[model samples]
Target: MYAMPNNDLEEATPWLDSGEQQVWRRWLVATAQLYRYLDEGLRPHGIDLAEYDVLVHLSEAEDHRLRMGELAGQVHLSRSRLTHTVSRMESQGVVLRRTASHDRRGVVAVLTDEGMALIESVAAHHVRAVRRAFIDAIGRKDLMVIDRSMAAVIAATDPASGPPDH
Candidate 1:
């Protein structure tokens, strides 16, 4: 149970009703289960979801590289966490870190040959997992609804309604 500190709530506060609470709970459960399935699927490749995400983002970038700050934004990771992840990948020769040419103090992450190979090996399985767990389980109409719903939620929550970090 999440413990809320005992504080007098004299002012009005938004709260979910029972139905809304149930929906939130179910969403949480489903998301957790899906994450676990995907994480397990990638474990044999010696990378977790976060690391794989970093790899994918880097691989898809122009010249297969991106600045650390840009990568953090694309992966939804804090700068510090991205630094640590990149450091580990660098040590494994899966990624190369270079000082930015324009800003010597800044760093860029480039996918090495090994990193590309690793992603190539894992991509097929990852796609299958995604398809089996999500797309295959939903009807075409429901999938459309899910996509639209997610887009709407993101538009509502994101500070910039523009394109997401890609």
Candidate 2:
């Protein structure tokens, strides 16, 4: 239980009410737990959640390639972080970076055959993990509600509908 702050209009800005606080707290906890659970499930395959996300995005790209900047946005990673992650993946023969054909100044990350193979190998297990941890836990009805709710949040936050961070 929380004591409501005295509404001294001149003294403080608006703050979350008890109901809003409860929702926010639960959102944070659920996200953290979901990521941890997925990461752990991928550990046996030698990839963390973020890395898996990178591969998944690359796999869906045209010719399995995307500009460095584009890939960063797709994976919700900072430019420098994507560079470092791609560098490591390059050394592992999973991906390679090259100058973009359309823009010499732009770098493009291309998924290698090895990377494709790796993703294929882990796809089934990953799907199962996702189902076990999230989909199955939330039945279809609830999942649909969550989907629409999340879309609303995104639209409200991003009125322009510009490129997303993820």
Candidate 3:
């Protein structure tokens, strides 16, 4: 594996240089702003970005359903967190949870017709918000670079890959 060079002030400790620090800070700010923008855009539809993400995943799954654990991973939520969110969505008539038919011990999250309708209603607006806040703002070439960069980050941090040797 290729390793990044240690460019710390001292040989024993690694630290980000000024340029790297600026990049890190900007990434943090941009991520926060983009999420807020998207969430706010969905507010009028009575769903936040997280809920919208869940609904999208469920809607695209077979029979509009997924095992709870699988859904949690897809939506980047913890099992406990997904449980709470699913409960709330259930109460709102957007989702339903039932024991998995094949595995009695497993739970599944299913999108209701209401959930599908809700996502269909907001998808266009959400796309516009995404374009306005991120895609258009970054331009096509930069967006491509960002996509590749994010994929690299995800690969490097994948749990199955274990820790880096360094």
Highest TM-score scorer: 3
Off by over 4 Å in 1: 1-11, 160-166
| Candidate 2 minimal-lDDT segment of 10 residues | 2-11
Which stretches of model 2 miss by more than 4 angstroms? 1-14, 159-166
Q: How does model 1 fare in lDDT?
A: 0.89
Candidate 1 clashing pairs, residues 3+ apart or interchain: none
> Against the true structure, what is every candidate's RMSD?
4.7, 3.8, 4.5
**What lDDT would each prediction earn against the true structure?**
0.89, 0.89, 0.91
At residue 84, what lDDT does model 2 achieve? 88
Off by over 4 Å in 3: 1-11, 164-166
lDDT of 1 by residue, 46-135 (tens): 998888999999999999999999999999999999999889888888999999989999899999999999999999999999999999
* Candidate 3: residue 17 Cα off by (Å): 0.7
lDDT of 2 by residue, 21-105 (tens): 8999999999999999999988898778888888999999999999999899889899999888999888889899999998899
